[model samples]
Target chain A: MSFVRAEGIFQSYGRRPILERVDVSVKEGEFISIVGASGCGKSTFLRLLLAQERPTRGEIRIAGAPPATEPGLDRGVVFQRYSVFPHLTVRENIVAGESFRTRWGRFGGAARRAALARADETLARIGLDHVAHQYPATLSGGMQQRLAIGQALAARPRILLLDEPFGALDPGTRLTMHDFLSELRTETGMTVFMVTHDLAEGFKLGDRVLVFDKPRWDPTDPDAYGATITYDFDARNGGIPFQTPEETLHALRTPGPDPVA
Target chain B: MRWINRQPGTALRAALVATPFLLLFLAYWIGSEIRLAANPSDRLLPAPGTIAATAERLFTEPDRRSGQILLWHDTLASLLRLTAGVAIAAAVATVAGLAIGLLPHVRAALAGLVAVVSMIPPLAVLPILFIVFGLGELSKVVLIVIGILPFLIRDLSQRVLEIPRETIVKAETLGASSGVIALRVALPQLLPRLIQAVRLSLGPAWLFLIASEAISADQGLGYRIFLVRRFLAMDVILTYVIWITLLAFLMDLALRWLSRRLFPWAEAGL
Candidate 1:
């Protein structure tokens, strides 16, 4: 069964459609990258998945129920800009997602110690155990982002959601994050859905590339940025052992600029 | 450590910075002394030494009034009032700041009240407070709260609101609940700013204390200043003024130190 499923996703802002009839599906332990041009509504789709924004029409399921008004530990997220707690120790942030773990941090004492211990192991996994006591403001951008990713994974969520997690980093840092993430993914075997405007990112990361095409925002030309689902593909195992741009190009036979056409 | 050495160059630079100000202050002190001595009977030109002597007396034999060293009585009283006032103000400021800063609806609702409150000078509330609570510590404390709360809430709330929205969203995606997002994500970003706002609030806190003390039941730094004013003892008045200012400076220093401890990387400096 698909770990995530979205069908007939239609989203619009003031009559300007962002995603129309966009369908997406991801299996367990799959890594899917959504890529498109700047206005491709890639972030919007991610936002929908995050429940930051809801689709005008469609259904989305994450493990079980779709995301709701209240956030749950089942879905973990990493943003482009590392949103680690600036004043908190790296350990505190890593355990931030473990609501299910520390039943009573408010009560303090032993429960809090357990929570701190959970945070400790997470920092260890992220190779930041040495800096566990350091604050995010003191950390390098890459380190902070790594902490953010670690924090999201702390509770061992069913799905990890990423929205251009490497977009804010320098090119070198971005590549490093990609490699680290791919390796981490292998160890964790998580289902990830990442959004990026760079086509290269789509090629590098996502197990399945899903493109969201927002038609246009111009009201004068009513049909501008018309929202459409350009294409979808099983980026990991559709056909070739490893799919390259040529194969992706051949796979996307549609008239648009999308590879999954 | 290399740069922070006890080098002659550092000392010379330090002396260079202090030389001009020190000389200027000496000139003023000497000038005032000369002017006061030139007219021993004169009421206006009180010698700087007189103020120093009064400060010494207040510090040592504090029983200047009815065998009571006014410093002990007044500093103790003023500190008690200020502590209670600022602590209450901190609680109010923090809660209001967090609420308005976090919620748009709360912000919109409270902005107008905050605006109206900010417009009213805290000292101006002395009359009403005196009438309501009498010329007692109660009135004084209430006045201080009234005077300080508006400025506290308005500034801290605005600062809290100014925290980057993207950061909050990022934390939420990391499975942080609303409380965690505000306290962990939003609060830390707002901390350095809140510390700044508290520093600013302390100034007004003391200013209001003096205004209230000048009129209320007599046992604060402001009361000391006022009573000395009646006897034309500029020494006592000046000493008290210096005392109050020094206290404010110390409070500011302590706050700066605490802030540094909390966020060593904080940029908004003294």
Candidate 2:
């Protein structure tokens, strides 16, 4: 059985459908990149994987069993912004990631010293050791995002989810982050599912790139039907879709930006 | 238009800030001089010198009847009531605000009720508070709480709600329980905001305290002011009013300083 499976999942808010017939299966250590136009329920799919929300229909299984009802230690996630806790120092944030397993949600005495030592190690790995005592607000955007990623990794989750993790970064910073993420992925051998609007980014870091789009469209009622997986490309072999990305984007109806995502 | 947009130099800006206060004092002095010239013993507009003398006497001399310096006694009493009311309000608002902001059901149940309570004129129920609590310290302190509690809760809850969903989700994905989230995640973020909320509520809290004390109190700044009003002692009244304003201003300054000192990270967004 696949390590992660979502079979015929559907989701809707009130009367409006957002996602439908979203089926996917992943091996234990696959790097699955999800890409689509805005408002195509890419984030909704990520939310389902995180177990932050339940699908209106169907179920998701992890390691041949039902996924946890709530977001759990098994899955770690990073977002484009506001991913790190502002009140905590960078080192304290790393400690927080690990401290979730403690009985009182915090460490004390020797245990805290051990956690702090481990946090320092993680900080050095992320190249944030020098500013570990500083709060997130003082850091530049790229550095804050780096700290966010490092904080998530401290928990040692089995699966790592990245939602447009480098979308807010500058081009220069984005390149460096990509290299950093790739190295970390190789070292940990953890499964990663990243959502991105940048097509090149989707192909570059992903083992398999999954595209989400609406199969059925009603121009008069734009939201009548929801989005689903339209293409699943094997990105490992430099396999590009027959249609260029510009043509593909131009063909789809973008109905403005995705409000919920 | 150019003049309107023109920025003032630091020294010029300081002068501009002082202009209104200087003008007001000049006007008051002129008015008092005119009143005194017309009638040798004018009580309504006492001279600034007379007011200053009265304040000094009130500060240093013990009261003939009670053996307590009336000014200090009244100030201590009023401050005690304000502190008790505000501290309780802060504690309650922090917990209630976090709950309303974090939990969907708590918000659904309490948000509207809190909104309605805030809308109801607090002073309109002054008599009810007095009757229920029976004209004691409790009634006055309770009045301050009722007057500003709703506003504090609303401000704090709104602030909590403003915290990004992404941050909360990030915590959850790291396996933080609800208790852990409340204590480790939400409370630290809310403390600086709680100070801010308390600062904003100070004016209304002071108003409620005075109003309640004016209605029924043995020793308070408001009570003292009302007591001297019967004899038409403008100097005494003016001194107490100035003292009250100074106290409120200092309290606001202290809270602002505390917020800055404790949560330097929060300063960046502001």
Candidate 3:
């Protein structure tokens, strides 16, 4: 059985359909990158997986159970914008990782000390120990994003979702984040689903890549129809080596003759 | 020329701030002098020396009938009413604002009412409050609360609503219940803003307090000022006015200091 499964997922915002009849099955510990054009419902799909919003039709099951109606500790998410609580210092923000396990979102006595120590350790691992006392606002953009990622990881979620998590970072910082994420995934063997605009980022980080698009686009009835998964690529064994972004775009635009066949 | 664009040092900034007050004082002093020169006993604006002596007497001397320092008694009475009114307003506003901001149904029900209530000039309702609560401390406190409560609720609701959707979602994914999110995530952010809202409302709160006191109270700063005005005791009235201004300034400063000390992380964004 798949670790996470979605069958005939359909989503809409009032009269506007955003996703239509999409199906996805993800294995445990697999890294999947979802790539698509803007407004192609990549985020909508991720939201469905996280259960931030319910699918208009069909159901998503995680670990043999239906996904919760709301986001919960089993799923941790990082967005392009830093998600750290601005009112909390770096250390406190990290300690918030244990918010789900602790009673009333608080830790006390030995548990408090353990939580603090774990937060400190995560801070060191993320190379942010020096700024543990600083608030998120005082940190650099790269540092803030890193702190957010670290905070998410500290929660020990079963799956991690990223929505253009490195889109705002500079090229150097973006590369660093990619490496950090890859290492973290390898170390923890956590399932990762990242939605990215950059095709190269998706290819670099994902073992499997899913492309979403409107197969039958109708300009007049844009709201009536929504996107679906157009192409699925097993990126692990593709013969294409080091394609330029333009080449990658070309290959994705016209996925030639179903290589999987 | 050198100082035109450059930021001022601490002493220079202090002097710059002090300059306006000094000029205003000079204007008052010169006006008082000219008025006194024209007439030895000007009742409208007393000389600075007369105001000072009145202040000394008010501060040190006991009242003939009550054997209590009238200034202190009035100040204490006025402050107690102001504190009670503001504290109740803050508490009620925080809870109401959080509910209205977080729950769509509550927001739908109360948002329009809040807007309409806020638009109604609070002073216009003073008579109603007096009639309802009676001409006691309750009425006075209710006046201040009614005057500021709607504004506080509106400002705080807007503040709570302005909390980024991402933060709430993140808190939810972190396994925090709705109650936990409200108490921990939302409440902490709202507190600093509550202090700020109170600081902004202080002027209005004081206005309502004084108006209520002047209309009915036997002993209060505003009551004393209004009473002395009938006798043309300009020195006593001016002294009370200055004292009121000083007290208001101190209260604002104290609230600001408390906000900064308690929530240092809040100002980090600034």
Candidate 4:
């Protein structure tokens, strides 16, 4: 049985359908990369997985049980920006992540000392130990994203969700971050669902790359239809098709049901 | 050179900062000299020396009847009331703002009401407050709170709302409860903002305090100023005005310093 499963999920804001008839299943520790054209419900699907928002229809199950109604310790997420707490020092931010395990959401005395030690180790691993006392604003974009990922991983969540985590970095920084993420994945072997606009990054990091597109479209009203999983490419064995570039364009070319008179 | 981009050196910056103040002082001095030349007993615009001497006397001398230094007595009274009003308002506003900003139900219940209340001129409600709370310290303090509480609540709530959705979601994913989110996640971010709101609303707070004192008060800086107004004691009034401005500036400076010391991280963005 799959560790993560979504059956016939549909999501919309009011009458505007963002996603419809979306189904996916993933084995434990499999990195699933979600890629699509802009406004194709890619982040919406990630949000569903995070349980930040529930689907309009259908349910998602993680590890044989329904996920928490709200985001919880089982899952951790990193966004492209504003992921780190601006008010906390780098060391404190990592400590904050681990502190959530406690009832009060803070550490003190011996536990706090232990948490600080663990945070130091994390900073060392992420190559950010030098600036552990500094704020997030002082760090370069790559460093901040690194801290964010480190902070997310501090709790050792079963599933790590990344929403275009490297979309804001420069090309050089992006490459380093990719390598950092790859190393972390190899170390933890945790389940990951990443949404990305860059297809190459998706293929490189994901075990299975899912393409989201609307099979039906209304040329007269663009938002008349919602996007669904159009293709699920096995990314592990160089299996991505050469025609994948045309997949989205092809979906756009497809026509929808007749518009109301 | 485009002056916009020019970085002033320390000495130059000091001179630049002093220019407007110097110009204003010079103008005041010139006007006072001309008025004094025409009418030596003119109480409308006292000479700078006369104001300074009055300030010295007010600061050092005791009142004949009460045997208490009136300036010190008035300042202490006013400061106590201002502190109590501002402190209470800050506490209430923080909690209410957090609730309104984070919880949808609370926001729905109170946001519009607060907006409506904020619109009503506080002075217009002064008589009603006097009637309700009486002319004691409570009424005076209540006036200050009523004058500035809405603005503080609105500002703090807006600031709380401005906190990135990602930060809150991230905290939740880490297994924080609503209380924990309010305490650990939201409270730290709001403290500096509270200080800023207080600093911003101080002007109105002082305005309310003075207005209330002027209307009805036995002992306060505002009371003293209004009391001597009938005698046209311009020197004493001018002394009080300068003293009040200095106190307000110092309070603002202290709060700013505290905010920086407490949350050095916020300095970059704030």
The C-alpha TM-scores of every prediction are 0.85, 0.94, 0.91, 0.93
Best candidate (score: lDDT)? 4
RMSD of each: 6.3, 7.2, 5.6, 7.9
Q: Which has the greatest TM-score?
A: 2
Query: What are the clashing pairs of model 3?
Result: none
Q: List the residue pairs that clash in candidate 4.
A: none
Please compute the TM-score of chain B alone for each predicted structure, in the order given.
0.86, 0.98, 0.95, 0.97
lDDT (tens digit, per residue) of candidate 3 on A80-128: 7848888888998899878644558878789889999999999998899
Give residue B54's error in model 3 in angstroms. Answer: 1.8
DockQ of each candidate, alpha-carbon based: 0.35, 0.60, 0.50, 0.59
Candidate 4: docking tier: medium
Per-residue lDDT tens digits for candidate 2, residues B117-148, read 99989899989998999999999999998989
Q: Which residue pairs come into collision in candidate 2?
A: none
Tens digit of per-residue lDDT, candidate 1, span A207-230: 777766654457677555556667
* Sort order, TM-score high to low: 2, 4, 3, 1
What overall lDDT goes with each candidate model?
Answer: 0.76, 0.90, 0.88, 0.92
Error of 2 at B237 (Å): 0.8
